[model samples]
Target chain A: MMGLNKKDTSLFVVVIVLALLAPFFLNPFPTDSSMAQFNAGYPDLMQRFVIFGIFAVGFNILFGLTGYLSFGHAAFLGVGSYAAVWIFKLLTYNVLPAIMLSVIMAGIFALLIGYVSLRRSGIYFSILTLAFAQMSFALAYSVLSNPKFNLTNGETGLQVYANDPQWLHRDSLPDLPHLFGLSMRSTYEMTVGGWSFSFNTGYYLCAVILILTFYLSIRLFRSPFGMMLRAVKSNQQRMNYTGLNSRPYTLAAFVISGMYAGLAGGLLAAMDPLAGAERMQWTASGEVVLMTILGGAGTLIGPILGAGFIKYFENIFSKINDNILHQWFAFMPDGIEDFIVAVIHPFIGKGWHLTLGLMFMMVVIFLPGGLVEGGQRLARLLRRKKSDESPSADTKPAE
Target chain B: MGILEIKNVGKRFGGLQALSDVNLSVQENSVHAIIGPNGAGKSTLLNCLVGKLIPDTGSVTFQGQSLLGRHPHEINQMGVARVFQTPEIFGDLDVMENVMIPCFARRDGSFRMHAFETVMNEKELVEKAEQILIDVNMIDKRHMHSASLSRGDKRRLEMAMCLVQEPKLLLLDEPTAGMARADTNNTIDLLKEIKEKRDITMAIIEHDMHVVFSLAERITVLAQGTPLVEETPENIKGHPKVREAYLGEAQV
Candidate 1:
């Protein structure tokens, strides 16, 4: 849990390679093929995959390290999105200001919340944060909605229109933001052995930022600040008695993680150019907690894996209908296919969450360390079995 | 003025008087031990010294500066660090990392926001922590998790955590409260070693007479939220008031 072991480092490398190569290797069907239902190669879904990955990764920094169960984290993400949207409307449409504003705003929000909430630990802290988040949600829906509709654009949400200033629009820019005069929004394509893939410019940008954020989180996880957070989590009283103020350390972690959420929100708005109040909903906030816990709370890469797994299931399961099930079971007998469809049909629409819930339960019950510990257990079992088999083979020399 | 002075400090929780007008002081670089029975408010006094509890009455002055209203970390930054009754080292962090935290707080006064520079690469902090670890004879276990150490070793690590700050005054609450004879002897030796190597003024609260007699230069006997006697350990060992206050009731 402290640092990456050799096996984990190799696994991390393998996972990164797989994530990069997934579009070409996993999605074999044409873009418009009926089998595209299972394909997560689309820009919209891929954007979500990374955006939520950032969200859960930030969350793991707080709940995972400090064991502070914050029920109001979504408020930070929502506030971040709103701040970013306002930046887009007021200033240029470039991502730099939007992201900066989001991070700063979220940090300020966390400072206020953490100042009050950190006074009490455990259930009290959770309740305090929950109440604050609800208060924010209420304000966003009620006051921030109609009167200053120009800022947030209210229930309709803020969206970019043709009339909006296009400072970031490449065709209009006198001197565009480019690497060696090449537009940042350019993509490079590659094809091999009847398989074609396009690496998206936006996706690459998101991937790069995520990697940087991931690196920062890793550095933080290994630092003294990180140690203080764990100290706060383990025993606040002891820490207080030890002439250490646990409050400031907890507040710092809260702000840093909140900034990450803001960055993610800004990136999401950059990809799609819309900021909706619904994005900051408590359910959305809870979704990242599920991802972090299901993946592995303390492990760095676990949250990303958790985010991808949940999003993959969410997209695939929600899209499946009875007709799609029938198409898959066309090769089987009518009786077996109908039985299988009947068993799975109820969990297709709103029921996709039921599957997520079951997966979360399994991960929690059987693998409390999340996917990271599960992987370690599997590796250990394989090594043991190998050693046992080799010894047995030597003993059977006569054979 | 005494280096670390407590004047008429009293604390009340509901109707219970945890500490009532308890006044004491330790001169610089002296080993001062505060002894009391269970629930005698020894910890409550230490809490007041380190700014954990705001006293209902009286003033706490460190080197003639007011200590009230300062946060614990700020107090630590101002050269006052405490080791807990229970060893409170960061369990997940390695020993070196655990020690490095106080060094960071001492140097920066707040968590540094830079994510690029490695904390270990800070030469002064690493050298200071390494030196403290050497003093505690825990240099060999510096790479291991602080939690993985034995009880005595955890106490040593936590002591190193405070020592890294180079505090003017240090506070210890029941530092050897729960230990076997061998571990207690080991802790006594470690404290003796640290005392000789560092110029730190420590106020230790102990239930172990052996530890108090072996380490403390001066002893303060606390009974019923008040200081009964403040004297040298030699004088404190034979005092009738202390004997009647504690030893008469127990086998000590």
Candidate 2:
């Protein structure tokens, strides 16, 4: 089905189902309930989920398959955002062209960086990539944003101002980033008694692209090219001696992944119409790496899960302020409530990274295969317990 | 001229000359074995032929084409498959995948984008890989990880990977180098069967006289980066130059 084997087909379907019904799945708590603070069905947060999901998925194609840890992947994402915002400023506010150009620009950037960076392997390659990304950050942050040729517009970021030359802009068209007249921020709020779900058009568009990219990723994973990438990771000497060029194969993976990051960057701009130099920061790259590792690096759906996992925590968990904590603990005795709030203060809201870091470390130490491995282990354990009556129900080797 | 011709291939590394004033020819369809004592530059000569090292003095050609200055993959693309001293199969891949990769290399010529098509959907390549595995007697262990395979099986898998490419010239750098006596015999038998079943030329570097005498149709005794004698295996055993090259280590 869809060029995938039965196992992959089911996985693809699961992603589609989850992505399409995210508003419901993410908004399980009632809108009026105290737990509604944790709900992530808002248009802004939902867009971030699918956008970052694309970024991590692309990053995995390089880091996961070929075992090339690119420390500057966020540069591609930043470049994509800048390219996208430039399109919005020069052309119309339409997202299609912006997304396309962002991908192409990112690919070209990847080619240049990968060509030089891939000459060295292991930690050297990583450092090379990091250097390139930092250079890109410097270029966007100051060098390219001068008054004579204001491309990135310095630290203020590049956004569609009232006096910009949007050649395709018209009275009939939406003033914001959109597909035709359908604005990305356009959301349909649905209320079911005390429960509320927000279905945003922008989120849906990003979700569809995410699904398409996910399918393409699956195809690439199963194709001969994918096998060759794995071969590269395993042993380059064997690959070269077998009459296969490993350099071009790795370059291709790097470029494809770069394009994915760019597409994600374009989506981010489309959602908010702003491209900042901070997107190109090294911390952003590290965050994606953490996401990939936390969710499972090599598995097909692991990156998407990882991206969503991190984004959800970043948005929802970080919103838990002292006021909200105190409100929740108001029902308790005064002394006990204050003690509990004080104890939990460091892991909530502003200290959300502390929570995230602790979880990431735990996942790394215990579930080295990431969240997907944890799921598989749980599934196996359940199956074993269910079939304990039959002593012959031994564990099967992984296919 | 033979299919592979080497003329005055001298290679120097800093002060030491690894291979100097070497010349030899491996004819088509003949198993030519180059035997020598340790540090006799046997491996260096093989490396020169496969473009792993560039000779300081002369020419190395396969099928009338020069092998100098070419990359390893480029050398491989010109119908030369090399088996390393230790089996260099793709350890991370499965047994089937280890064989299939060479087929892809042979068909695609180094790099081709299979971004859309699935690996299993490549029916002809899959069939070819399967057939090669069967020939190597590894079809039963096709699903096993190549790394987990026994040492003998790794050698066989490496052979399958090379053979699937259908190269005209096969280079084995001590193919039976760290094997049990029984496994060595099995490899010898496998090589014999491969020689009988296919139209291929082999250039083998060996320390083991048993393997050299059994498989080599023409034997070249190399000593101090030079070939002292090139003759039939029978004549090579009797040659005094062969004994002198071996420093009286010859039990022939």
Candidate 3:
């Protein structure tokens, strides 16, 4: 809202209102119905909607503005998750310590990676980042491995036992710390008829922070710093000869994006009491790049929507089974239902990636600016058609 | 004492000698021009002065301080600003925003920091940037993106960006090289106006004799990376060595 245009400001307000009212609205759906399975309002997937949204939004700060395509940003995300988990083990299982550690760790990691990677520009820089991230992933897998109990636990992940103390988690403890030590985690449960909604304390906390981060990102996007970043992307030589050094500005943006990734990683562990090194994989890093490109890189809110869309499809489509497919096509004869299942089965199940890949290719090729431009084009086309039919009616501007 | 002094500066790049025993001294506030042929190393000398390249021998001193090992931005902070031959401006930034970068650099000093302060709310920075924009005749186009401006206007904006830094010495490397005759005249006028308003030293490299004769109080000529002559423009026009190296046949 701070720097948003009229349309974006309204859209942001609508999103916040929807996130708040989702539980109430979803409460009417049947408890055991398959439709409920598709509801993104569920805590596990809903948390991810905001978490990866933060990741993509942060990544936009670097690749979107500076044109520095980093292939190893996932390493920072993984570092953040590891730092957050370590905080859970040593300090309090509270979300605050985890978030703080994650940010600091990510910043340090970015500083190190940025110092070296920034030495080279363009494709070489991207390769440097990728090599560093792969090294990190390998180190995490081998060095942190345990013979008996896993430290990082490798691909299996490290989960916090309930016996572990949640220092600032109020719901987990009756007599939590007071005032300065007041717990931020507060859960409220509500039931309507046969439906129950577990309003998570952590989810709201993450949503509030994500909103704040989003607002900060918007400010960064519009500020002089943002202008400098865009200039660097446009022409580094021009910036250099203008008596400005491009390195420091690009580095600052990189560090800030890394901090945001760290914040997201910390939130992930907070929502679920586990941290996995798998989160830092190259593929995981590539996913955010895909999300940004598919949603329209450089446009605000596009990346977030892209994150939500990808996560939603991944969750919903992966859950589709033969039985569900057959049930949906049951209106046809039994043989027809079986035949339809056979055709749609591979595309929906294990083959979900092929569908996403095809969609990504189409979006990249046809709508290079992503869904945002696509939507704008559609709106313009419809308006043009209407204007042609009634020319005088379109005299006034749409704004 | 000369504010900027280059004593016996020489540089070699492997097999090629770019500059050899080149000595230049600029009095505190004078407009000095360097005229040279294609490979005479005028730009190489300028690069040494601004710390883009270090000389193989001799010392470059500005305000009695060595500029040998300092970074270009640091050299700029030391009050030496350079304008490229081509208009070097932040294309994505507006005219005023283009002017504001030097203000931020001069005010903040450090190139990169997580200041996290309201960059636009810096009152002094905004006022200085606006004032400079007015000086450059770009006040009306303050909100226009620099890339969209005409070539002349882009050059003006770049000049304004350097001027706002309030450098003790300004360097222009072939400022009007690609400009049309009209644009070249406008650029000369802009430089004249800026010189009248600011107390500054200037070292300029130019191929155009008309622009150089009109603006430069004193001129230095170079041939094959070695100084041919340094004299007043009137004397330079008549000097035998300067004429032989550059102007002899052209003045026919």
Best by lDDT: 2
Model 2: DockQ score: 0.82
Per-residue CA lDDT of model 1 for A52-114, tens digit only, reads 888888888888888998888888888888887776666556667777888899889988888
TM-score result, candidate 3? 0.86
Residue runs of model 1 more than 4 Å from their true location after superposition: A1-19, A28-36, A84-120, A147-149, A161-198, A235-244, A327-337, A385-399, B247-252
DockQ of 3: 0.30
lDDT of 2 by residue, A1-399 (tens): 978999999999999999999999989999989788888988899889999999999999999999999999999999999999999999999999999999999999999999999999999999999999999999999999999999998899989899989999998988999999898888899999999999999999999999999999999999989999999999999998988889999999999999999999999999999999999989999999999999999899999999999999999899899999899889999999999999999999989999999999999999999999999999988878867868787667557
What C-alpha lDDT values do all the predictions have?
A: 0.78, 0.93, 0.81
Provide the fnat value for model 3, as a fraction from 0 to 1. Answer: 0.29
Interface RMSD for each predicted structure: 3.4, 0.6, 2.7
Tell me the tens digit of each residue's lDDT in model 3 across A20-52. 665665345667775766656666776788889
Candidate with the greatest TM-score versus the true structure? 2
Model 2, which residues run further than 4 Å from truth? Answer: A323-343, A390-396, B248-252
Per-model TM-score, in order, reads 0.86, 0.96, 0.86
